[model samples]
Structures are given as structure tokens and as C-alpha cells.
Target chain A: MKRLRVDRWTGQLLLARPGACPASTPRTALRPAAASRCAAVRTRSTRAMPEIPTDEDYADGTDHTRFPPLEKLPPRATSLPSPPPERALQSAKLAALHARLSLPEKLPLQTLARALVDNSADENPLFNNTNLAFVGQSLIHYHVAEWLMCRYPRLPMEILYAAMKGYAGPAALHHVARSWGLEHAAAPGGEVDPGLLQFSLHKPGNAIVTLGYKRAEAEGLQKYKWRHGISSRVVFDDDFGQVVETDKATQLRRADTEYGNEYTRSLAEKAYANCARAVVGAIYAHAGREPAKAFIRSHILSRTLDLSALFSFKKPTRELALLCAREDFEFPIARLLSETGRLSRTPVFVVGIFSGKDKLGEAAGPSLEVARNKAAMNALKSWYLYSPGEHVRVPSDMLAEDAQPWTPAYIDMGEIIGR
Target chain B: MEAVVTRPALSCCRRAASSAPSSTRLLLNSSLPSGTRQKSTAARTRRALNIPPHPSFLHPNKTPESVASRPTSDEIIFNPPSSAPSVFHTPFKFLPKTDPRRMANLTSNLFASSTTIQYNYSPSSAASPSAETTTTPSPESFPSIEGPPVLKPRHHLTPQDIEQMRRLREQDPVTNSVQNLARQFQCSKLFVLMCCQAPKEHQQKIKEQEEKVKARWGPRRRAAREERHRRMEMLFNGQL
Candidate 1:
């Protein structure tokens, strides 16, 4: 039989001489014999297996390596040149002084003072409203700017960015722009040329509304990029002032009804007054600040306004409407109309689901009262869809087999764009 | 002294009468509350199981009453159950004394011997040796058998890669169970796992229709798609 011999220490087997038997070497061969004998005996007298060296062994080796033999090194302390005694003493003194100052408690306050002073020099964009616009005509720009300043006096540019982006609307944009102007715009651009006004009002950031028209304009002259901030790209020519006022008035007129009862009459007037003020606040802030840029942004990109306060007003209006409808109150629609005023004059846009014959509705007149009466007549047919029992569905012709579904679109303007 | 001597004598007499063979046992029964004597007899049987026999306590007669009175016969006297077992019953037969009193004795003994050994070769006069060794280190010296080495994590590992690898392994558990594969890949078990794939069940479920999407777009889209496809085929055939 062929046999292999192993070096016991390495656990490696080696070829054995043809004539050699098991006990060829005392050290190597004896280990296996002893191991075999231990297995065979199976008694308490059996010796334990030898341990294998592990990573810890190398760690111990490295630990001992810390102390090198002095004989192997050039005797620098005795033979090599050393620093002069005076210099050494000076260095030791300096090092001691440094060590003493390095403690956290011992740090100098001047460093802290410098950091604080350096931060204030930065340009704060929250103060600049040249790029924002509100949705109201009567709103004095200063009032909106003042409210924004009071509401968020010390907000950083990043926070302002988030608020504007998150709420993106004509109302919110107007508030931001007014605040921005009160804070940033030291000088206003030249007069609004008729051509520039027309072009800019249709651009994003220029006209703040529910459905911004600037984005859909043919020329697309306005850029949508830095409706954000600090893009040295172009000076803005926003026209949210004109576009929003025209479209918004149309929406209000379509939803309003005549207020007959004393209570219903009073609330509708107040809601209208409050909304008008909020719209004015939203618009003037954007107009007064960076009217050009702000107008274009509101009018064009994101097709939204800085009308944050409008949402707050709408909340109560919606609740009151629903409450009046559920209780079958005598003049619920009248109450809604009273607060809303003539829908055409209402500063904010009111949207509802589209159903029934006409796909669009709008109205216009000299006063909001006259305009809203005409618009409400247009929107009345679909009011039942929002009522308790009416079933609402998208028109069969409007459904797409393979496309993302969107919210139903409707118009409240007294103007009938398409029958 | 007389009381002690009479007590033993009485006990011996009791043991002798009780230990008589059965025939004589019945005749010699002393009626001094023999029921109590029966109880004492039972106790003696228990003590025999515990203690080795002592010659002085063994009775001549093996009757129950005589067995009760012998000092060894007093083993028949019932003792209350102990809260802890006797040291003799414990598994550690050769355990060192642990009682505070015994420990004090051992410590004093060690101190006395060590002091003597030192003094035998010293020239100092007498004083308490305990005062001198009070300065030595205590028995709690060895640090809680050094705990296993702790491992710190390497923070430089790429988080994105790790997350991706984890998702991959989670998706393929059947093939990824091998530990060696994880080691070869140098990734954690979670990192080796793959994420769940899109469920076939979702595909099988039917969705309810509300408004058809075409109303949102327009019927012109069909014509648009056909025109685009026709253009594509024409280009593919090198005719466009």
C-alpha cells in the first residue's frame, strides 16, 4: 500500500520512503502515535490537544515590537547633534503655554465673536419680494408686505424657499413677493412698457392664479428657472397684476348667489371683505417688491399664486356651505353669496367638479355684484353634484384607457368659452 | 453531676427494655406514654441512616423503647426540619469552611502562621501582626476575567452599494443562504438579500373603472399614435 508521511507541526503530509515504517522520525511520527494512542485509550489520562496559535499571538508580537533594540539605533542622545540648550528651553516653554491654552475652558472668545459677526453679512432673500405676486386688485402692496414681515420676520432664505415652493399659489406668491420687496428691492425697474407688460403678465411668476396662463402663452419669452432665487440670469417682468385680476373675477362671479337673510347676508359680506383684503395683500406684496419677476412667476411657471390667506378663508366658507346645505337652512346659498360678494369681484378663485351641459362658465360686469349674478346663473346646474344625493362621474368621452387620471376640470367664469 | 449520671442510667434502662426480642418486647413494655415512645423509635431509624454508629449510644436490647433512650437511641428523638441541609449531605464533601466564624478562624490562623514564620527570623518585639498586613492588596484584584475583544465598525463602507446588495439578496433567499457566499462578497446578511419583486397577484387583480382616460386626453390620440407608428415603420424600412 502507498503511504504518505506528514510533518506533524505543519499538518502537511509528505511522501514516505518505500521501506520506511511509521516511526521514521521521533518528533513528527511520535505526535501522531501519541494522538492515536490517546484516542484508543479513551481514559482520563489522555492528554489535551495542543493549541493552535491565533490572531492574538500576532497581536502579542506587535505589542513586544514596540521596544526596539537600542544597539540597532545610532546613539542620537550621545553621538548625533542636538538642539542648543537655550533653544530647547524656549521650545519647552512655548509647548507648555500651548498645552495650557488648548483646554476647552481656556479657549479664547475672540474666535467665537468672529464667527457670529461673519454670518450677518450674507444677503437674506426672505426680504426680497420682487419675484412674487398676489391675486387681488384692491390689496395695497404695503399691507401684504407688512403682514409677511410680521409673520416671519427672521426666517432664513431656505425656509422662505420651502414656504413659497410648498404653497405655490397667487396668494402665497404675492405675500412672499411683498415681503421680498420690503426686504430686498432697493430700486424698482423702469416703467412697465405695454409690450413688456403684456408679455410678462403671461409669464410664470408674473401672474398668480388657479390656472396660470403665462405657461401656455405662445412666445414662451419668460424663463421658468429662478423663480427660486439668486440666478443672475434675467431681470423679471411679471404681469400677475393684470392676468390674475381678470381670471379671478370671472371665478367669483360664477359661484355667488343673492343673499336674502340677515345672518346669511352679513357673513357673505364679511367673507368678501376679508377675501378682498387678503387678495390685495397677496397682490401688492408681489407687485411692490419685484413686480416684474414676481408677476411672471405667478402668471407662468407652476400656474399658482401666493394666496395662502385665501385657503384659510375658504375653509370657513366651505364649512358654512356644507352646514347650511345639510340643515336645509332657509338661505344657505344666499349666505354663501353674501360672504363671497359678487363672484366677479371676489379676490380668490373658487373651483368645483365639472358636470352637466356646459364645460365652462364665466361673467363680467362693471361691479362685482353685477358680474357674480350672471356667473352664478351659469354654475347653478352643477351645484347638485356637490349636494348630498347627486351621483357624480366623469363624462364617458373624457376617459382615457391608458393614462394617469386627473381631477375633473370646471370653470366658474360667467363667460361660456365652449358650450 | 448526679442528674447527668442518673439520666444516662435511665436511658440505658429504657434502651434495654425496648430492644428485647418480640416475645419479650411485648411483656417488658413500660407504659410511660408508649405512644411517644413509638414516635421516638421512628426518629432513631432516620438517625441511623444519617450517622455512623457510635459504640456508647448503641443499646444491648434491640427493642423499640430501649433503642429510643440510648444516646444513639436518642436518634429516635424527632428533630425539626432544617432550613438548610447538614453539611454532610452536600455534594462538596471537602469544601472549605465558609461560615463567617469559620472564615474568621481561617484568616486568623493564616495570619498567625505567617507572622510566626516571619518572626522566627526577625528581631522585632511583640505587636499585633494583623496591623502590618492590613496594607496589602485585596482578593478582588483580578479584573473580571477580561471580557471578549469588542469590534468597531468601519464607517467608510458605501451605503448605497450596501443597500442595493441587501435588496438583491432579499429577492433571492433560496440561492443566498450560503454563509461562505456572504463572506466572499464581503457583505452583511441583510445586504446579500434581494427585495421582493412585483407580485403576479397584483397583475391578476382587476381594477374597477370610473371615468375612462380618453375623455381627459381626446379621441385624436388614436390617430396620432397610428401616424407615429406608420412613420416608425417607414423609417425602419428605409423609406422615410
Candidate 2:
């Protein structure tokens, strides 16, 4: 058996023979990524002058790429002897450090290999033996999962996560939900159900309905009502000390106020409309496409009627006030009547302020535009409330023929009656 | 000397509504000329230019012929009725007469008697005491009647009565409009202002003055008030 001499001094890979002339052998054979190890191996031992082969001895014609044969290998030579005390100690130390740095079986690539194995599983593979893992296991994965669900509902969740993040990575679903206004509904059996999403806990009663998820309850799981629309109300009262500037202040003081004052009531109405729009946007996230018809009828128009009874004011006062401020009132009234055609009910009417016995002004029709036209006409004519001589005709061609007739009624105009 | 009452100030309340763009405006009625209907080769050539039709105005429903088909309802309920006289000249007596016969003819716990003392007056109730004097006419120095007087029953007031009350309230500087003042006193403005030239803290003063008047006048007034209460209880229970 060939006894290999381990170079303990410099921690080199050495093959040395002891107690006799060393047999000629090539020593510079080891290919380490350093210079000193190769040099040490080459000069370590020499007993071979017999058939020492030089570098040019065998230029292999067969395959120049392959290693040369072993018989024509170089001779090894011995140089300085090992230092007595410190030499062996240093060698042992170096050997230990090298071993610690590069363990024979230490595999750094195992983590990467394991991840890849879990990622690519075979179709219908066995559970334990398979090396596949679902790609989307994190919140980031869910975000991509939801985004894909938005545009393409049937896309695989793992592929979505992988494609969205490029690799299986982190994502935020809440942010995505807010932007698209769609969310997964909570369903039984641990599966997600696609639904028009809403984040609010309060079930708002409105025309639009949001998709919601909730745990099964005694009330039943689907019993969770979702709100997809918004509405606001404003009542005028002296409790606010007559003049409120901001919409926020108006809402804060609705309880103790009277709805008799048109100006404040009008202001409150506008604020409510704005608030309703915001609420609709918040819940369903699509105010543009949706006509908002249901939102108007249910929250604004219906609630205003109920409020009329509560405020002791006539219902028309509140409803017409809202209509007068509607968006489409700017168009000519003739055009409005022409399109919507004749109205069955009088638009909303405001009593004239300048007539001898101020007559009630009548604005009628279902759409908010017609209502405003009638109201504005009454205001312009000062109806029965103002003296005809002093009445101010508002400048607008929007008033239609049906809105022309102003009937006077006997009302005590007080001392300023005809002025 | 009726004081002029100021109009109620406009409230600073915001107008409530989410706005939308105005829809296309159209004329109430206009028909296209018959000649324009013919699609001649030249007209068809012009039509290829794709210019919007000379914006022919039509009603929103696209039918300009029937503008009056839809009659909209006005919400204000208190406008003066048509065919009524232009000037309001009703007498104060037109105000709901609170006579005993009218009161007894009704059916509610409360009735507003024309008398000075108003007791549980539910206008719907129809029980009232009939007070009549059968003896010879009393002298100029007639003795004051004891207890609440059985006044006429005033059921409901007319608009003219309301105006009169408002006018009467306007005469007093310290008083607000009749509508506002009536809300506070829970009564007509005509009578309340009649008692005071200058609006003072009179309720307290009257309570104090009444103490002296009752002491001097003895139990006659107290007995009258008690009778008023009794009549109220009877009226409330449907007991005549």
C-alpha cells in the first residue's frame, strides 16, 4: 500500500515516502486555487532521476485537451526540513482553519434547491415525495392574487403571485382593494368568493349594495348587508344661531334646528349631496359608471319626505329646495320639458316674495332639473309673496310655458306688504 | 299704529345635492319642414359631411308637440286659493267663534273658548257648559261673574284672522311677527298685544298683581277657574 505523507507544516497536500530513497513521482499534480500549495508539492521530495519527463516530453496528438500520462510526470525534490517547535504547531493550526472554512459536505445551495423543489410540483403528484410548494404563501402573494382576480377571475393564485412579483414575493391586498374597490368575500370551506367589496362594517340602506364577507352567524352568513351607496341630510334651525358657514358645522347642528329657512336648508342639502357622493365612492368605487339613480331615490328623496313630517314644515319646501340645486337645472326649461316631456306633478314651487298677496310659485316634474326651473321661476317672479310692481324677474330663458302662470293667494304681507 | 315686521332672515344653510351635467336642452315644439325630409342626391351628399343636424331643438323626450302633457305638483300647501278676492277684508268675527253651542257641537277634550281663561282646550272635543242669565238686566254697576266665563267656542281661524292677528302683533314693537309670537304664547296675537302697550316681563308681574286682585276680589275668581277645570275634565271624559 502506498503511504501518503501529509504535509503537516504548511498544510499542503503531500505524498512522501519515509526511511528510503523516495520513488520518482510527480508532485505538482494537485490543482488548488493558490500558488504556494503547488510550489510546496513540487519541491517537497526527489528520488527520481530515472525517467524524469520534461514539459515537452508528451505533447499528446490524441487529445491535447486531456491530461498527460503519469509515467512522464515530474520528479519531486525535498527542500528545508521542518522547523522544530513552531513548525508542527503552525501546520496543525492552518489545517484546522481550512477545514473549518470548507466542510466537505457543507451545502449552501441546499436552501435554493429546496425552494425550487417546493415551487415546481408535478400534476397530481404524491403528497410526501413531491417537491412542489404553492407559490403564494404570503400577504404579497395575496395582493397579486387579488389583482389577477380583478381583471381575470379564473387565473391560478400561485401563478398570479409569481408573475406579479416576478418571484414569489410580498404584496398588500388592502391597498389593492381600496384602489379597485373589489375584494374577496368570506365564504365557507376556507375558499375565497369574489364579490363587490366594501370595508365598512355598517350596513347602509341604499340602492347600491357592496359585496361583503363575514363569519356565519345565527343571522345567517349572507345576512350581512353591505352598503354600496351614500346619502346626507341638512335641516335649518335657529339652534345653530341662524348663520352657519361650513357644511361641517351645519351637520353638527341639525338636531335643534328648524327647516323653515330656505337658505340654510339649501346649504345643508348641498353638503348632504357631497357627503353622499363620497360615501358611494368609498363603498363601491365606481361613481362614474353607475347612474346614481337608486342612490338619489332611496336616500335623498325618500328621507326628505320623512323629514318634512318631523320638521313640521311642508314636504315640498324641503324636496324642492333639494331639486333646485340639482346639477342639470342650468339647461333651458323648454328643452327640459321637451325631453322629459310634460310633467305629471308640478315641479317644486317657491312662493313669490314681491306680489301683493304672494302666490305660491310652482315648479314641477319628476327629474331634478324641472323642479329647479319651476322653483327658480317662482323666485324670479317673487310669486305672491312680493308686490308685482317690485318683483324682480330673474334673467334666464329656462322657464317654460307651463311654469308661466302665477296665481295670487291672500296672505298677510305685513306692513311691507306691497313694497 | 301697526309696526312693520321684518322678513325672516335667509338661512346660511348649504344647498344639498350631488350635481350632474345638464342634459341637452330642446325647444317645446318645432317640426321639420317637409322639403327637408326628402333625401335627394345633393342632400345625401351634404349628409356625408357628418355635420350634426342644424341642432333642431326638440323636447327632452324628443316630442316637442306636447309640453303640457306633464303637470308637476307644487309642494307649498298654504298658497292662497285661486278665485279668492284680491284684498283680504274679513272681519275679526270670522275668526273661529268659540261660542258654547259650537263647542258642545264638537267632540274633543280641549276647546278654545272666547273667554279670558283658556282651559284644557282640545278643539276636537264637544262638551261645553251653557252659561245664561235669566234674571232682570243688572245695573251699570253689575257684580263681576265668578269662576271662568263660558265663552263662545273658537274652532279654527281663517287666513284673514291669521293676518289680522299678525297685523295686531305688528303694532307692538317688542313683539315679533304674529307667527313667531303666537308660537311663544300659544295664542292669537290680537289679544296678547291688546293687554300691553310696552312688552314687559308681564307674566311674573301679572301673577303678582293677580295675588292682590284675588285678595281684594275674594274667592269669586278662584271659583270661576275651578269651574273651568271641571268643565275641562268633563269634556275630556265625554261626560257632558
Candidate 3:
């Protein structure tokens, strides 16, 4: 068997497009990208020339096109940043994945292959998942946001953002992709199978999957931990209601983080998330909107997240009172419902918070004060976590061809502000 | 915990159940949801719920007192141990109608463990205590007479009482502290704090004094405090 050419022919492929005679031109100016491995591969290829067929095989008839035959470039492709787009047709794993996900037939294998390549693996936006991920991210966030807003109308902005992150953020998407059971390449290369996810942790990925306004003082959001109001977050933050990280901050983070560190794990998660988004984006691009929405509902929104567990109130009683006052309800009063082991080592008190005749919430705790506080918190949570029926109509449902006449959803007037 | 004491009763149920008509046994074994009920916890919980034990559960030589005590009525009991819930119990989630357990779960456990605590100070139980003269006249006060233990918050404070409490607290916070005001007004300290506040200067002075004390903390102590604060923040963020 003829040993693979490896990365020795990188500069050769870069210089010689299809129909160009590589034998005539001298290997004078090699790209800096191939500078390190170029010399070693050159010597190996020269020695292995006798056994392996020379460029004459390709020049004889095949690959009259501009680029090399993408279908048969695993040997030479290793030298390039990304595998040629045509290589996607020959990837068994890619086809298996397509079948497994039941992706729309219109979404070609080439785009699915391209989705596997992260920006860190291939910088060219044309080949990488950046743009597709961007499209997919927007679509995902929109669907998730509309569903959340309609379902639980009274969630505070902070909790709303948390729920969004829990549903569509990188970590969540990473798990979603993992559930699909796609294998990833050890390292990105043109020689690797198109089906495998390709990413680099050592090199910082520069892909921004969604568009958001990055404020001039974005660094302040990280360094000083300044409180940016919800209004500002709505205007200036990313889709998940997070301050957009400046490129400099990302670079600094990458520099300090060691190999196999949490940052690296995060980078891997983000890449996986991007890949999932790109698949959706490809669907939207190829099939249509309905299929894409169906994909999101099945993959992303179907995942369980306990929204009530997201609340963290500093002054629950005060907040509950404020919420009652704003809603024109009677002030909440906490009454002890029961006490057990009161004079023993561990006392348990159950408290219920009542507003007029209605008992809003109840909780049991180790002490009367703790129980009262917990009950108050529970009351505030119930008020904030109000949900229309699980099947409440979302705005996206209106986008369908046979949707009903739109019904206005009732969203609360933001969270109750406290002293 | 390792005793596994319910087996004997279970064996008796099986023997009695097997001898009962085949139709009744088949009804008892009808079907559970198609899951291999995992682990000992589920098994133990299931065993604990074998209510209205089979007739053969009683030993041949068992005394009359045991049979006499147990109610023969067929009413279902709401008793649940304060531990892992019985395997028959389904949680309050929006389960679809198709779930095999949905029908049973919907019909039961609505008030599971609601009245677990049955002990409260009754009037008869408190007859020995006689501290009525030491208590205030307000009905909201922890009654020295110790009538029935009341869970309801007493709406005994009139507008004048609230106004007077506020006046006293405002005039001299040192004299009318939360504990002192609660004692004088015959209410809870929490109620006293809610009714009024100490002057702004006193609050400021207290805050400043706290700051001074915090400033004097050693570096190790400061770091521990900072770490504690970070953990609390993480707890709120759901990262803890």
C-alpha cells in the first residue's frame, strides 16, 4: 500500500488549482500555515514517489474543475484547513447521521458536513458553521423566548433570561447534541471524516453565533460586575440576556486557560452547540420554516427545566407585599399552620401565606421564622411563575398556514421592585 | 433499615391471595406500568402500602385484642411515612392521559401527609398550667390560659394600637426595641418591626458600627467571609 502523502503537498495544493501544472512551478513561496510541517512532508513525498502514482493520474482526465477532486482528497486534504466540500458525498457517517436525525432530504450532505466544522477548525466562514449557527441561534432563541413569554407570563426578567439559557444556551444545546450521539474527531483536519465534529480548544474559536450590540464598556460588565438593568440587557445584550463578550476578553480567557481546563470544556460545549444550531439552520435554508420549528420543539424545547427552581429572592416577604400592593390584592399575612417537636432538638413549623381569603403558598421549615420566610418566598414564586395552560398558543404557532386568529397573551408588568 | 420485616406479611398475603379465586388474584396482578421497578426503595415502598392485609395475615394463635383493635372498615387510609414516597404515588406533574398510572394518581394523594402532625396543645392538656394573670389582655398574645393551640394569626390589633406602637418606637428606639415593643403591645417581634422603624440616624449608626467591626476582621476571616458571600451568590444563581 502507498503511504499517504500527509501534509507535505499542502503548499503544492494551495498553489496548483485544478488544470494547473504543479510540476513546472518551483515550491518557492510556502504559506506560513504549512511552514512547520512543509519541510518534513516534502522529503517523505520525494522518497515515496516511486510507489505512489504522481500527479499524472489526476492530470490524465479527472478533476478538470477549479479545486482538487474533493471526493478523493483525504491524503492531500489533510494539508488544507477544511476538507473539500465534495468529500461530504463519500462520508458514510454523515449519511448515517442524516438518516438518524431524520433530517429533511433537501438539506444536502455537504451542508451537514460543513456544520461539523467549527470556526476554530476552519477559519473560512464559507466552510465553517459560523453563519449557519448564527441563523439557527436566532431562530432557536426566538422560538424559546416566545414559548416562555406565552407560557409563564409573569417570570421576572432575570428568571426569564435564566430559563432561556437553560433551554437554548450552549450547555443545554451541548447536551442535546450529545443525545444525538454524534462522534467528534480528535482534532480537526481535511483528512478526518466529514461526519465527525471538528474543533480546536488550543486555538480560540472566533465564531459569534448570534448578533447583539456590544456596548463600548463591555469590559466593565465582566471586571467590575456592574449591574446592567433589564432594559439595558434587552437593548444591548445577547439573545440569552448576557453582556456580549468583547474579542479581547475572549482572547485573555483563552490565554490563561490550560489544556483540558474548564475553558476548553466550555469551548467544546460551544462548538457542539454551534453544530446543533447549524443543523437547524441548514434545515431552515433547505426545507422551510415549519420543519425547522418542528426540529426545535422536539430537540430543544422538549427538554425538561424546572422554572420554579430558578428563583432566588433576597427579601421574599417584602417582594410578596409589593406584588400584592401592585396587583391591588390584600397584604399577605403568614400564619403558622402547625408545629411539631417544638420543645425538642429539631422543631418543625409549617407556615402558610394568605392574601385575604386565598392561601397563596405554604412551606415547612426548622423554625417559625424560617418557615414564614419560606412561605413568603413560595407565595412570590407562585405569583411570578403563573402559567397559562401548557398548551397556550405561542406567536410562532401563528406563523403556520392554518393557524387560528391571533389571541393576545397576558404578560405581567415586569417583576416587583423592592427596597 | 435492613430488617425487611414486611416479608412475612407479604408471604401470608400471597398464600391467602392464591387461595382466593383466580379472578381476584388476576385483578390484583392486572398490570403496573411497563417498568422493571428499580431498587429496594421502590420494593419497600410498595410493601408498606399493602393496606387491608389479607385475612390469612393473622396467625392461627393470634390473640383477640389485635383483631379487636384493627378497624374492619374498608375506608382507605392516608398514612405515608416521612421518607421515600410509595411507588404507587405519582408526582404532581402534567402527565399525559396515556400514562398508565395517571388514572390512579389523579384519584389519590391529593392530601398526602397533610395532617401528619396530630399533636397540638388542647384545652384539656393545658389545664395544669395557670399563668393567666402574668399575660397581657390582647387576644393576639400567646395566651397564658393555653386554650386550643391556634394556627390562625389573631387580628386583634386596632388602628390605635398600631399608631401607639409606632409612636413609642419613634420617640425612643432604645427604650422601644422590637422585643420590648412586642412585649408591651402583646404581639410578635416581627409585627412590631413591620409596624414601625427606628430613626434613620440610629440605623446609620448601627450600620457604621457593623462596618467598623467588619474592618477589624483578620485577612483569613475576611477571606472566609468573602468566600461565604460567593457561595451564597452561587446558591442564588443555581450554580451551587
Candidate 4:
């Protein structure tokens, strides 16, 4: 098999094969001193070619029986900062990870190895997973957002944003990468195994592998805690419906400290998440969309999240009343359905909110007032939680060849009232 | 046989519905002027039939709900068949009954109760020592001889009202208990306590009253309160 090429933009070492033509010189010019050092190594290696083992000799048990002596190079020897592409084939971890994910045969080990390298580890775009991660992030975010929109059609903008963060956010993706048993290299270098996730914490790169429009007000968002309207967020924010801030430089500076800070931890998390995204991107690029989607479904979408817990209502009763008014339904009335130990310190009062004769929602609380409030909240939740069915088809389902005719999914008129 | 009978009935109903609109339109035309009649009839018919205007038509944007009927029932319960297990239930079936994770999953489910379950208290059980004192009082006898009224407190006190409350509290601290002052001013007991400027002696007395109240609480009650407070703190801190 032809050995993988490390792109020259990385400023890493370009090892020359003994028999390879001298015409295949490095594309980018090295420093004058580094160029002289490379020329010397090349001439010496060519003269010592007779002593080096050939491919055929290594195939037999002769060289494998005894440990080979380590070759010591000069301190200034030029080499790839991250593991070379040639090492991808020998990485047992990479092979095991490939098998564990059950990726298609079409996806080669080289692409998977490249996916493990973060932009920080190798700044070269051609070598790092930045481009692959961008593609993967889009795919993941698209699936996540469409699924969320279809499943919970009536989720308020805030809750929807929270749910997106809970499922497809950096923290969530980091959790996914961790759960897959993918270990990170202590520090990124040519010596580290290609299987491990490689990213440098000390020398961070500006690898914002996300599709989002950085809002005009993004600069002041963190500094002032500027109020961003939900409408604007949909237009300007990332897939998780958050303002995209370009603060990697500040974060990198903070990460330089010996003791790991929040910024450093988040940087690591982003790197791991990007690696996971890059894997998905590599799969999509090789095996096509269907297999990539299936891989995502099994690994990411299958995890359970309680969407109801995302809700935080300020005045549920008022909201319910407004919803009823908008729908032209009967005004909701809270009635005491049941109670126990009414005068006791720990009384349990069950209240039901009803619109006309139909019971909207029911809840129990320590006091009647609290029970009534809870019942109102439940009523609002029930109204908001209307789902056609669990098997409701999303927009992407139409992408399949044999997909049924597109049926427009149910869409609500957003929240009854915004806070 | 049922299909044969229902088919004719359905056809007759359909025919009646199709013909009624035209007849109404004709009636409207005969009674009114040409220009005003067309506009009035269309508006009247739309309202009477509750039919939304065509989207392409030059009309005001109608409420989305106007085109769709509201759900008759508030709750939509989907119960899976007992014989065949649902895909939803399959994920949790692997967990053993003793697993605390299973308990959490069950509690966080849509129908989980917010209130604590009262094991000792039941509606069907005979009146216990606490039951008689806890009987629901009539609205007229809200401030019953047994206890204070369960009315919601209002907190719209003016500056003058606060002054009056302070004066009342200072004159007779013993008589003006926080509860009594709260009831009088239609405010929370805590609010009344915060607003009042009691003398040093009165503050000492208030401390003693607080201790007495604390002593009255049973060990189980105290423990339950503490547990509840701890849980609330954990929830607020996002630790739980």
C-alpha cells in the first residue's frame, strides 16, 4: 500500500524513502539551517541504505525475534509533531476502535487516524481533522435539531435550546467520545499512538469547527450578559442556539497555566468533541450518508434525556389562561380533587385544572395553593407536549429512496407568551 | 347489513351539507343589495360555517387555530397493548427492579407525582387524633377556633400602612404576633416581621417564642424539613 503523505504546511518532518525519486521534494521551503540538516540526513541515509532492513526481510521472523536497537537522532531532527500517517496501520487501538464502531469496509484506517488529530496537534488543515469535523458537526447538528423539532414540536425557544445543548452540545459530545472508550494522549506529539485523541492544551489552535453566524453583539454577550432575543438567536447562534464567541485566544492563554483551569478543561472537551465529529465526517465521506446517520443514531441519539426537566415556568397559571384564550377554549379552573391531612404540617393536596368538563392536568402538593399552581403547570405542559406520535417522520426521512410522501409535521405557534 | 344502512345515511347527510351553503347564499342575495350583499354574505358564511378563507385570498391573516379544530379532550393518553410490549418500554426492561436508576427513571416519567406520598394518612381510614383538628372549615368560619385562615396573603402595603403596622407592633408586641399582624394587614408573616421594629425586650421575647415553636416540632418533622431543605439546595445548585 502507498504510504500516506503528511501535508507540508504543518512544518513537520518529511522522511525520504531510500529508493524514492529525489524529484519529489517538499512543497514548502524549510528554514536555511533546517534545509541543510535535512540534506545531510538524506545523504547519510542513502549511504547507509545497505544496513537498513527491506520490506521483504521484515516479513519473515528474522528481525522480529530480537528487539531492534533504537535509532538515536540529533536533537534538532525534523519530524511530524503528531503521529505520522504510516503509523496508522500499526495502531492496535485504531483497529479496535474501527471494529467496535463496526464502520464500513470502505472507510480506511488512514482517514480514521487523521480524524484523531485535532487542529491544535497539527495546524495543517490537510493533516488535521478540522474540515472533517466541520462536515460531521453539521450532520450531527442537522439530525439532532430535526429530531428535536419533530419529537417536541411545541418546545419553547429556551427549552429547545437547552435540549439541543443537552444532546448535541460540546459537553454532550465529549461524554459520547468518553463513553466510546476512546482515550486521549497526555500530550500531542509524533511519539504518541495514532489511536489516542491528540490535541495540544498549551499551544491551542483557532479551530472553530462549527457552522454559525457570529452575532454582531457576540463581543459584548459575555462581558455584559447582553439580552439576545430568541428570534435573533435562531438567526445568529450555533446549532445549540447559543451565541458563537471567538474567545479561543483568551482561553488558550488561560490554559497556559500549570494548574488546569475551566478554560483548559473546556478546550480539552472541544478537542475530544471535534475528534468524534471528525470520525462521523470521515465515515460520511467514505461510506456515504446512510451509514454515517446510522452510526450517529446508535452512538449519540440513543442516549436518554428528560426533555420535561428543561422547562422553567415563571407564571404557569397565567400562561395556561393565555393559551386557553388563544385557542378559544373555556377558561381553566383549578379544583381540589383530593387531600389528606389537611391541617397537618405535611399535608398532601391533589388539585386538578379543568377546562370545561375535561381535566387538563392534575398534580399534588403540600398545600392547596401549591397544588393548584402545580396543576396549572402540568396543564400547560400537557398542552405544550402535544406530539403526533413517536414515529413521526422528520424532514430528512424524505431523503431516502423509498420514503413515503412528505407529510408536513405539526408546528405550533411558538410559546403562548415569552418571558 | 350495517354498512348498507350507514352508506345511504352518509350520502344523504353529505347531500344536505353540500346543498345548504348554496341555499343560504341564494337567500342572502335575494335580501340584500349587490355590492354590500357579496361582502356581508361571505363574512357571515365564513363566521357561521367556521371555514377559514383560502390562503391566497386577499384576507387578514387568520389565526392558525381558526383553520383547525381544538382537541375535545385535554389529555391524550397512549396506553400500550398489554400483550405486545412497546419499543418505549423495552429499553428499561433490562434494568433489575432493585436498581436505583430504574426508580429515578420511573419518578422522572411524565406522570410522576410532585407531592410526597402520605403513608399514614388516608381518606378511607377512621378519624385519628390529628384528623379531627384538620377537618375542612367553612368559608364563613375561615379563622376557626382551631387555627388561622388558609387565605392567600396580599403584599401591597403603602408607606403609611407600614408605619401603622410598626406603631401597632411597638405598642403591644405580645398581642401583635407576626401571624396576627400579617392577617390584619393582609401580608405574609415574614413580611410583617421584617417591617416591624420591635424593642430589645420584645426581640428577646420573639426569640423565646421562636424556640418554643421549634421545641413543639417532632423529631421526624424536623428531620423531614431538613431533608427537604437539603434537596432544594441541591436542586438549586444543579448537583442533583
Please provide, for model 3 over A1-419, each residue's C-alpha lDDT reduced to its tens digit, 9 standing for 90 to 100: 98877567765544433321122212122122332321222222222112222455234333333334323343355577777776665566877888899998777887899999999999999999998998999899999999999988877888889999999999999998988888788888777778899987667677677768989888787889887888888898887788877565665466456556676787789899999999999899999999999999999999999887787877777787777777777666677665799999999877666655445666777767666667666666656766656788998788788988997877666768821
DockQ of 4: 0.02
Candidate 3: residue A270 lDDT (0-100): 84
Share of real contacts kept by model 3? 0.05
- lDDT by residue (tens digit), candidate 2, A1-419: 96755434432112222312323222223222343321232333444322223445333232422322222211221111111111111122223322332312221111111211110111112211022112112222233233333322222222232344332111222222132322222211101110111111111112211112322231332245432111110122111112222233443354235543544434333222222233322222222212233332233222211110111112323332333333122111211211233354544321111111112232333444334343333332221122222122221212334455543322321221110
Model 1, runs deviating above 4 Å: A1-160, A163-254, A258-419, B1-184, B188-240
Best by TM-score: 3
Question: Per-residue lDDT of A392-413 in model 4, one digit per residue for the tens?
Answer: 6889888899988996776766
- For residues B1-240, write the lDDT of model 2, one tens digit per residue: 122222331111111111322231121112223212234456566656564311111111223332213323532222232331221111111112332333355522111111111222222221222111112221222221122332222535556765665555546544454456655545654454543343345456667887887777658778988897775444322232
> In what order do the candidates fall by TM-score, top score first?
3, 4, 2, 1
Give the least accurate 10-residue stretch of model 2 chain A, judged by summed lDDT: A187-196
Query: What's the candidate order when arranged by decreasing lDDT?
Result: 3, 4, 1, 2
| Docking model 3 quality class | incorrect
TM per candidate:
0.15, 0.16, 0.61, 0.56
Lowest-lDDT window of 10 residues in candidate 1 chain A? A193-202
**How much of the true contact map at the interface does candidate 1 reproduce, as a fraction?**
0.00
Second chain alone, TM-score for each candidate: 0.19, 0.19, 0.40, 0.30
With candidate 1 superimposed using the best TM-score fit, by how many Å does residue A345's alpha carbon deviate from the native?
57
lDDT of 1 by residue, B1-240 (tens): 011224555576568677878766565455433323332354656755575444223432335555445555335532343221111111111112332333443444333112111112121311223222323222232121112422222444476755654565456544544353355456443334332232344323312122344446566886897886775444322232
